[model samples]
Target chain A: MIDEIIGLYNYWVVIFLMMTGFYVVIASTNLVKKIIGLNIFQTSVFILYITMGKVADGTAPILEEGITSYSNPLPHVLILTAIVVGVATTAVGLALVVRIKEAYDTIEEDEIHDQDDSL
Target chain B: MDNLAVIQVLLPLLSAPLCLLFNKARLAWMIAVVVSWAALFVSLSLLVMVNDNGPIIYEQGGWPAPIGIVYHVDILTAFVLLIVTSIAAVVMPYAGKSVEKEIPVSKQPAFFSALLLCMAGLLGIVSTGDAFNVFVFLEISSLATYALLSQGKDRRSLTSTFQYLIMGTIGGTFILIGIGLIYMKTGTLNMADLADRLPAVFDSRTVHASFAFLTVGICLKLALFPLHLWLPNAYTYAPSVVTIFVAATSTKVAVYMLLRFSFTVFGVDLVFAKLPLTEVLLPLAIVGILVGSLAAIKQSNIKRMLAYSSVAQIGYMILGISFVSASGLTGGILHLFNHAIIKAALFMALGAVAYQIGSTHIDALKGLAKKMPWTFAGFAIGGLSIIGVPLTAGFVSKWYLVLAAIEKEWWIVVAVLLVGSLLAVIYIWRVVEVAYFQTADDESDIQVKEAPLQLLIPLWILVIANIYFGINTSLTVESASSAATMLLGANS
Candidate 1:
């Protein structure tokens, strides 16, 4: 039962983060906030990958002076790549938001839509 | 010789960053144009090689697959590469003047760099044999695309980009999860190895679940009817050049990936036999076709209308595969190429119009045929193709699709396809009427002349290619037919 609780914990947190991020994206009017939500959602995915890589009492996969047991390094490498991608995504998202603010003078999605309608 | 295949993707990847270092616009355009042409040349060479030989495999950094990253260049990859690189070649020259106008002068360098990087990433995603590599390149292209789309002059573009980012992230995460699940079960990331190992665990629930996640995720990315909510707005609001690039290539690449996964990695029996994919997919495709056309009819903005038409065309491609016949598959793959060219030509024409008039509303296009004759002529040709008129590329694809449907005795599908073309005729006619028949809103605007030679050359190149390929379809038909056969016959 203890193992089951622990096993279920990671997915639960993932679900929580995913939902929170999704809700923020849907509910927030600010473009920046939506980007933040996107980050949160992406971060949850990273967590899920890291959790999948976890091995009981496993160490980092480094050929250092004295390391024997290592957690699965593949998922770690994949996640690292994903993190790089996430950062790139965030940077681009923010840049787009800046452009949006410049154009509309507002970050709110509804206001932008209203402006588009008026146009 | 085997190792040289990796350079097919790597050359552009390396050139992308060099673009950032060059501050001069002319130098950047020169470099970008050279790189695009080089990529196109490489793709053509790869196609010739694939035709002469068979698939080429390149293990990265002198390592073997199942242990290290690998890249595969099968006929399918070569075919897709030809489509993508050729489109880039045409779009690059247009990008020279268009980007200069739309994007700020200071950001032009970075914009072109991102464009090249995005192209490299897309090519990488299609060429690589590693599953995780697919996700990496998928993100690379998606991130670049978000930047490209946000270049629109409206704040609504930001919201649209954000919406795309949110949805794209979710889709990416889902794809990552699916890849991870596959990795967990098969213990290999190399696609060929996965294909070999998957049959052993085909009955595993984990495998099934992974397939489910992947199909759903890819469908979302590809903007299949139900999951296509992000596409129209993204295409409609993005900068004109970005719209042409994204509209022409991005989702088509996603669809290629879908075909790769469905036919190559997962095996046809695994997808078609155990899962109710065809049933689910076919119905949604039909809905996408009918509904996309209907939505397009209601759209006042030409760009937005074209965006919806793309959704419907995507449905036709999907419809081709649902029949699961060699001819059906041929229809699907042919439509893929035909739609890419047709849609690219249409959007490029629109871009030319936007270049002069600064808008794409249908009202603004009145008397455009008289004023901008070449541009509208190209559009009318594209419109004919879209309506599946005889001796056009669109007709060839639709003809094969209808043939496949008749062979299967699914006459209703044949009828639906015909009806879809008729609807296309209606919408295309509206544009035609406005362009050819309607009087100019201002007489002075009549002096508004044709698009510059730079734009017309590429536009007409595509127009003429559409006509030529439609008439002499030996190459496209042979490739598409064989690809269809391979897809259907895999694992049989």
Candidate 2:
């Protein structure tokens, strides 16, 4: 029982983080907080990919004279690309928040809804 | 010549940055027009090549598949490529005049650049064989769409853009997770490789979870029914040109993604037989059709009404898929093409109205037929297509859908299809009545003039296409059935 729990703990943590990030995105009213939630969710997915690539006693994916064991490098490269995409999304999200603040004088979702409704 | 598929995507991508170098709006518009038409020409040739020679597979950087990215040009990809590039071509000429009036001169060049980038991203999504590459291009198109939406004149567009940004990012992240899970199980990201390896592990819990994630994630992106909260507002407030392009292409590409994954990657037995996905999809699609048409009937603004109508049309595509027959898949794919042309024409006509009267409220369309006869004729024909009137492209797809349902003895589904078309009739007649029967209110002093020749030319192009494709069923029907056979034949 203990062995099974320990073996799958990384995925459990990934699920926990994913659920929390998803919850924050749904529950929060603040636009910046929603963006932060999105980042957390994406980072957790990155971790999920990286965790799956791990090998027992594996070192960094580098070539050497004697070393034969290496963690998978493809997922790492994919995550690097994903991180760049995540950063671009964040930058655009923040720029949009700035525009929203200028247009409506508030960044809270409910407040924005109220204002739009009044219009 | 062998790298023509690569050039189809590369042409638009490379032109985007070049558009940024131009300061004059006219120069930028000209660049966008020329590049988009070139892309269309390339797409048409690719379609012909695939039709005659079968599928063409091009490897990136001279690397083979399962190691590096590959551009797989199958019949489905070629067909969607034609739809997307053709819409981009038709919309660009209209975009020049629409943007000139709506957006400031300084912002026009960047707007065109963003549009080209969006087009490149969409074409890339349809062409690439790598699973992760879809997510990357999905984000590229999404971010560009957000920028395009923010260019709307109404301040409310800022909020709508933000809403779509949040939802779209969540969708993208979910897709990434799904891809990671699939990679974990099979150790491959190439879709063809994954299809080969997945069947051995089809019964695993992880595989099932991954399928769920991918379905939900793609459902969000395609604005399927209940998850479609961001679409009406995004379409309603966006500048008409942006609405026309995205309305015609974005969700349609997402539907193609769903088809690719469900039939090609997951296999029919796993998605349709081993699981109860079709059961869930059918009911939701029925509700989406009924509710979308009902909501569209109540909307006072013309753009919002059309946006709601798009939600319902997506439901028709989903309904066709859930039937899980060769004829049904053909119906779905045909709808993908037919809807693109029909909606593009409808939105362009509405755009012409907005250009002339500066609003898309049904009231603004009052007596519009008297002033803009060509534009209203386009709208009236497009509206008939939406209602699935005989001898229109819309009827072609709906006929296949109804036949598929009847073949399966799904009597209730047939009823839903007929009722949905009837609802479409009511909403379309509402607009036609306002445009033709009612007189314009004399107080506003709005000039009664026709749209410019630039907008009219493209608008009629799509309107003519709707009629031409409806009359000639050889191209759409043959390609759709072949694509369906290819997708289903892979599984059996």
Best by TM-score: 2
| Runs in model 2 lying further than 4 Å from the true structure | none
CA lDDT of each prediction against the hidden true structure? 0.86, 0.92
Per-residue lDDT of candidate 2, residues A9-37 (tens digit): 88788888888889999999999999999
Alpha carbon deviation, residue B75, candidate 2 (Å): 0.4
Q: DockQ score of candidate 2? A: 0.72
TM-scores of all models?
0.95, 0.98
Docking class of 1: medium
lDDT of 1 by residue, B222-289 (tens): 89999988889889888888898888888888888888888899988888888887998899999999
Give the residue spans of candidate 1 off by over 4 A. Answer: A1-3, A56-70
Q: Worst 10-residue stretch by lDDT in candidate 2 chain B?
A: B439-448
**Deviation from native of the Cα of residue B42 in model 2, angstroms:** 1.0
* Count of residue pairs whose backbone atoms collide, per candidate: 0, 0
